[model samples]
Target: MSEIRFDLVTGKMVIIAVERAKRPHDFAIAHQEKKGSKDCPFCPRNENMTPPSLVEIKDGQGKWLVRGFTNKFAALNTEVKEIDVPSLYRGEYGYGVAEVIVESPYHDVTFGNLTLEQMKRVFHAIIERYRSIVKDEKIKYVQVFKNFGPRGGASLEHGHWQVIAIPFIPELVNREVEGTQEYIKKERKCPYCEIIEYEREAGVRLIGENEKFVAIAPYASQYPYESWIIPKEHQEKFEEIDEDSLSKFVEILKPLIEKYEKEFEMPPYNIVLHTLPPRDIRNYHWHIEIAPRLTIAAGFELGTGVHINPVSPELAASILKLQNL
Candidate 1:
């Protein structure tokens, strides 16, 4: 039966249309990685193409594995300019930072190709960049995300992630904070904490888990095969996670993407890290949201801001758990 479910954490709603659902294989798309062109800036030996790295992780042989640098075509700039605007339009200087974290030196491989040790180093780069960027007092929010394929908003095929620090807190973020805080106040407990416990007990939506994290297709999932990799503990910050526990995160993430490649034919997807704003860490537990770009938002979705998911979270989790890996 089709029904509407509201997300207590994000305060969003989604319609699960059971009648329109199909087999998991039906959503497969061949998202083959393209060969790296010599002119590709992210390619190795092309260091001159981009500015010097802001942060870099190198192997024992001193070969750079991951590099973080200011985006050449940054949407936000660090330069602060005074602006006196007319009354009709109010704006401030585009004072923020945009950076790209090259996940791998090899351009042909997607993030899924990174070895277990390599994946940890890439995240080490990510957490370092995130911590350094968030320290800037001018920035209110820092976003860490990866666009996997062309359909997922990547102009470049190389596996990389972007970190953007903006001057003001975004509307959706503010809403997330406000809404989740209210849930905490009403329930007298952290909703995410209870969710982990609840879903663990339920097991219907649970996909996988490790010592420190749980991977699940959320009960209110808005997209097919969408999942959340959340810390088992009630952690407020992503970078604050201890080093020993990071392997647990990498363990769950690597296989899920492998499963996606095998089952979904490497469908384009976005990996979004949801954490608290720099200034406010109230009533929030950080998580990594995997939003697969299998379906497009059409008129109903765009018009109502409500997503229609053909497959239910139960089915999605079942299919994902079918993987022996």
Candidate 2:
């Protein structure tokens, strides 16, 4: 029974990796496939099922290549009345925007099958939504994520991503911000930037890189084959990546995603984009984390917030590197 501990010491999120009882293969979970209607509402032609487009990238005929619209069953409704919080225990109405990004018109198209151009459009659409949401004075954070395959939390089979603009910073983001602040005060350096420089020098856990970005399996990977995509430069906001660097980012991202698909037989995965708080971009650095759904959280991990990854990041990097070979 191994126990891993993560603590904040002098503003750094220090992770103590310990030997766990389970082996790597112990993390694997049985996968189940979902059967559904071919006429899923998220499919291009069935756009009527969703709310009218907040924004759409259109073709010459005005048919959409990709579209953004509000989710009908939104978890946070923007129309709700706001409440004022008093003291340590604050209560506020859930007033936020939840929008869906429909990736393509093709009913059966998956992200893995999308062309580079298509993927670029998806990335652009996400940026566009983020920019629009941040303009709302009430909104504080914009979260963009994809739930691929059934296991990763996608209720629909159609290739789509979700964006939620919340009135408050999420707890995870709050923790990260506090952690970064502490690290800066203690070491006069950004923890993420330091990790980036260290990873680049060591090269053992690196998966891929281009002029502007690098993808690496972190020194303490929480899951087998987990990887993070970070800007080589310390930029706090994803929107700040200029058009040239954005193109480079797209170039680097596609091949790595393809590599993951090939290596794990198109394993189910969750992709999360973490950025600085809307107003605090100067102090934070943005990154993307891709965690493959290769393992399930058993009792030990769930109860203790510790992960037991069988494959070390060095091995995962090697496997990812082989895709080019």
Which predicted model would earn the best lDDT?
1
Model 2, CA-based lDDT: 0.79
- Pairing residues by index, what is the TM-score of model 1? 0.86
Give the lowest summed-lDDT range of ten residues in model 1.
Answer: 26-35
lDDT of 2 by residue, 112-192 (tens): 778777887888888898888899978888999998877787777778899988777766898888888899999999999
Per-candidate TM vs. native?
A: 0.86, 0.84
Q: Residue 224, candidate 1: how far off, in angstroms?
A: 1.3
Highest TM-score against the true fold, candidate? 1
lDDT of 1 by residue, 1-325 (tens): 3233345566464433333456666434323344566877898899899988998999889989999899876767677767564555434556778899999899878787789888898889988988888888989989889998888878778789999888777767778778789999899888888889999899999998877988999999999999999999988888788887788888889998878877888788999988898768587889999989999989999889899999899999998873432
Residue pairs with colliding backbones in model 2 are none
lDDT of 1: 0.82
